[model samples]
Target chain A: MSETLQYIGLGIMSVLNGPELFSIFGIGVPVAIVMLMGGLLTGIAVGATPGLAGPMAMAISLPLLISAFGFTPDALLPVFAFLIGIMKGATLGGAVPAILFNLPGTPDAMMTTLDGHPMAQNGQPKRALRIAQLSSVSGDTFSDIVLFVCAPFLAVIVERYLDLPEKTALLILSISFIAAVMGASVGKGLLSVSLGLIAAFIASGSDLSPRLTMGIPALREGFSLTAAVLGVLIVGEILSTLEELWRNKHALKVKDVENRGAIDGLQRGDIRRIVPYIGRGAVVGTMIGALPGVGSTLAATLSYTLARRRHRAITASEDPQFGTGVPEGIAATEAANSAVSGANLIPVLSLGIPGNAAAVFLILAADSIGGFNPGPAVFTFTENEINPQLVTAFGIFTLMALGNLLNWTVGGSFMRAMGVLAKIPAHYLLPVVLLVAMTAIYFQETSMFAIWTTLGFGVFGFFMRKMQVPVLPFVIAYILAGPIERSAREAFSASGADPWFLFKSPISVAFLVLSLAAPVFLSRGGKKPS
Target chain B: MRRINQNMALGAVIVALALFALFAWVPNDTVSGFVESKRGRLSIGDAMAPGIAFGLMALSGLILLLEARKGDMPGALEQRTFAFLLVALTACAVSFGVMIWAGPLAVAVFGGEGDTYRNLRDTAPWKHIGFVLGGTGLVTTLIALVEKRVTSNAVMIGLAAALALVGVFDLAFDNLLLPPNGDQ
Candidate 1:
């Protein structure tokens, strides 16, 4: 306990003494504020628009930030903050179109339109928007707090027992966790995971001719993480979205609304009604976040499902009011998604394995700029090399907390202001996003290859989405495969070809046992296989 | 589809086995031998023959079986997209062949123009062409720039550029007619 405290103290002191910490706090905090405001405005615009989404916004912003700022840590801070802020705002922003226009800005926000648009037709647009915005802020703030508190505690424990064999076991455990947590069938998930592992293996380097390449000189150095991620997430998603556009060209278009208005203030009754559901959703979201690749969308869907089930069980006497764009639905969805943002960072920070595409990009950015290879060693290495700078972690949490708090305090009114701003045409938005993405990819390595890869991946991502194959496994596997392979090799070297040596260590034995048991436990209470 | 899955699984197992064999039987001393050979002190043929020979044999056995099975698979050419993919694959191979004499940039420009820009317009043809041209030019320029600025050996940058381009293309063409590029 004392040692743990000492480490925490050291972490704090490291932050306090470091010049970079001061610079980060000084520059990052204010820039974060500006970006948050800008993102909030962008989110409202995108959310109010017919076809745009939070992820699209993120993809567009990612490249622009990378191009404008390069891979510097200081540069990443505000961008990440903006991303988080926009995601929060967009959740509510999406409800605008869902209500007034009978269109959802994003797929996950479709549920809101069920009752929201009906309420708008009934002349309760203000009430519906109020409920949605308030519930969203409540959930988002709650989840942010959960992430801020939980991640470091998990990190501390992870740091204590992290070693080569253990790290390898942890990686295997992450793969298993992802497969278990995925909404897809186990067979499909396993296939995707296997493919991801194979992809990573192909991209990995060897002393004599890089692995798996058929004498292609360009492949000798292996694949770049930034390129791979951009390809899989942003590019893939764009392609998929485009395909949807092609297929659904004649789909019913929502009539555009004339006068968009702001959400009214939430009543005490509304707050009281949603408190329990919000708490449950936040907890569920945070837990899902901790698990690799089980991101916010899944978290929100699961939480809503669970909330609905619980509501059904408890309110048997009354007609179950779930999925009615009620406070509970908004609370559950918002909390779950917000919590995931923070929870997704746990594996990335603790194990150096990114849990999602966004986290993977952050890891790559960190690698390129900070020269800090994330893993078990990051804490130890940073403690010794740049201990004074470690305060940035603490500051990040604080800033995240502050950002969420600020968003909550003024978020509803801001949303009200945003309804007016959502009138921007898609033509203007799409080209800007494209330009930003292109520029960011160009800056990543200053190579055209990265840009092409991003575009290509956008298409692939699109297909994968259409095919119902989860992309998270691929991203997670790619990020973790290197460390897992390296750790396994080291463990083998240390144990001198003894297979049982892995089991001989108590730490490794315990981790392996837990890893083996996770699938059974997760599968047991899992929702009836979709 | 089931047969393809089965074959893929079998190929994976064979590759795993081959890797295991290399890890077990191949001597660690070959790393030094390769380094020495590269520095012109000794020929890799003499110094690392055992490792290289064993590795080649194992790799060939795995590849041949996989390829034969892949070739025999039904509906291999049924998809026009798959046919286009094959053409792209052949173009890449030809470009690599050309690279031996023409160097990376010439082959890259030719490959880019032939494979990417020759297709029909789905969205904006000029936009797509611009994307391809800019992408190819960026790769070539980066290799040249990096060679001058960092390493004099443009091979490393060229290789990096090629992998990026191929990765993007592979993602764009989701069909599995062409094997994934070995290096990512």
Candidate 2:
């Protein structure tokens, strides 16, 4: 307890003592803080815009920051602070469009649109925004706190107990769980996952003589992660949206409302009522977030579904259904999604694996920058010693706290403003988004190859969406497949006369069985969510 | 005109792809200049792509075929839009192909620095970006205009977008190492 308190005190001291205030727009702020604010500002802007996403912003910023900072120890904190800020800011910012315009800015924000748009149409935009803001910040703080307290301990436990077979089985468990979580039919979900595994396999051979390059020079280089992701998620979204507009000729824009509240932020009574919902969402989100590969969409969807169920139970014949712009609906979705921003980093920091796409940028950046590979080794300590990486992790937690504070203060009004702005026509907005996507791709990879890759994936994504195959399963599977394969191979090599090496460990056996059964269970798990 | 059934069309494509992946890919690679030794005994790693692709194709094919087998009326609205999307996709791919592959050829025929191919490859974001933006924008605008889905000012909008994108990319990301357009 004393050691924990001492570390917290030292973490605060480290942040306070280092770095003088630097000029951002000529206003003096600490370099670290400014980067945080700058990234947060950029993320909110990107997240508010329907066609753009936070991952795109992170991908675009990473190379620029790497070049500017020039691979120094001092540079790491500022760059990471900026990234952490963006990750947090984007989650909350998605709610802006989801609420006012009924357009989900990101996939996870799909739940937000249910109640948020209705609330806006009903002239309670302010109330909805306030509920969203409160829930988001609270959930983020809760998850960050959990991450700060838990990651080191979790890393130690895993480092001690988990063998290669266990790790492989765990990954399989994650894949199965994620496949189950995705709403697509079992076959489609499995197909998406299998395709991702195929993509990973294509580029990941030790011999590296272009295994499945199909004789294309570029294919031999394999797909750039950023390009593939942005292409499928953002560029594909752009193409899809454009197709929608093409169908309509002029897709009607949601008319702008006041986008502010008559009453101030949440009332005391309202806060009291919402506290339990926020708590539930935060708990669910943190648990999911700490897991290796499952992501924010499930958290948000599950929480929203649970909230609706709870509401249905409370008022058996209630006039207001859950989707009728209820504050609880906004609270549940925002809290759950926001909580994911912090908790997703737990596995990334503790183990080497990034849990989701947002965290992938951090791994990508860290790998390129060199000198720091974030895994269990980063958490090791001896007698009378402190782990430097642990200290940095604590510092990161402090940075996130500041981000949360910024979100509460300036983020609320900024979100309100975007609520009004999000109603702008897609035709005007999407062209610029496409341009930005291209520029980001080019600047990062410095190759037209990356741009073409993105465009290709965008078309592929369009088809995948049309076919009703869930994209998240594909993404999650892609990220984990290499690790799973590597671990399984290691286990195979390590086997001491055991042909069924994976089935040797009871934990592995149980998890593998679960891996096979989870999808079947999910398929049978009643269609009515919750 | 009888509307082509999208499900049936999709199912046929998937089945064809699955068959190609399962049967033809490995044999074709072996026939080509690839190592006959490696091709003769394919590893699990090597087979993963074809195996998975074929499986995915089969699953998608089955789903789409099932949908088609169950007699259903086509949503008149969706068929034309879906067809239009395919057209748009074709336009995009064609423009992209030209932008990347045909830039040097265009330079060779028209005008540019010496070693047109090398220059096109080296000055990727700056020189080649011009081809990409210009070609993609032109094709996209022309299609949109022809479909009457977009206004005639699409050309102007495309031009403005090109200027803005190139300018911002050049100015802000100096560290991006993009070669300056048109000879150094």
Question: Tell me, what's the RMSD of every candidate?
Answer: 12.0, 5.6
Worst 10 residues of 2 chain B by lDDT: B29-38
Model 2 CA deviation exceeding 4 Å by range: A1-30, A59-79, A107-124, A249-252, A258-268, A288-326, A351-355, A367-378, A382-392, A496-498, A526-530, B1-82, B90-157, B177-184
Instruction: Give the DockQ-based CAPRI class for model 1.
Output: incorrect
For model 2, state the Cα shift of residue A322 in Å.
5.3
How many clashes show up per model?
A: 13, 0
TM-score of each: 0.68, 0.80
Task: Name the top TM-score candidate.
Answer: 2
- CA lDDT for candidate 2: 0.69
Model 2 clash pairs are none
Q: Under CAPRI classification, how is model 2 graded? A: incorrect
Candidate 1 chain A minimal-lDDT segment of 10 residues: A13-22
lDDT (Cα, tens digit) per residue for candidate 1, span A1-530: 54435555654443333233124545532555566667766766666665577666765566555545556666645665566556666666776776666776665566566556665654556776777776666666665666656565666677776666776677777776775566333433444555556556552534564445445676656666766776676656543443333334323256644433534445558778778987888788788777776666677789888888887777755563775546677667766666676677777765677776556656765665564455545444342344422344544454456556666667666666655444543322332344345545554455545555665565555444544446777677666666666676567556655556567678788877876676556645523222
lDDT string for model 2 (B1-184, tens) is: 2222655665677677777766766445322222122435422344533464466557656654564565431322356656756776666655555555565555677655565655554454436554555544644453463346655466666666656655655556555543223212
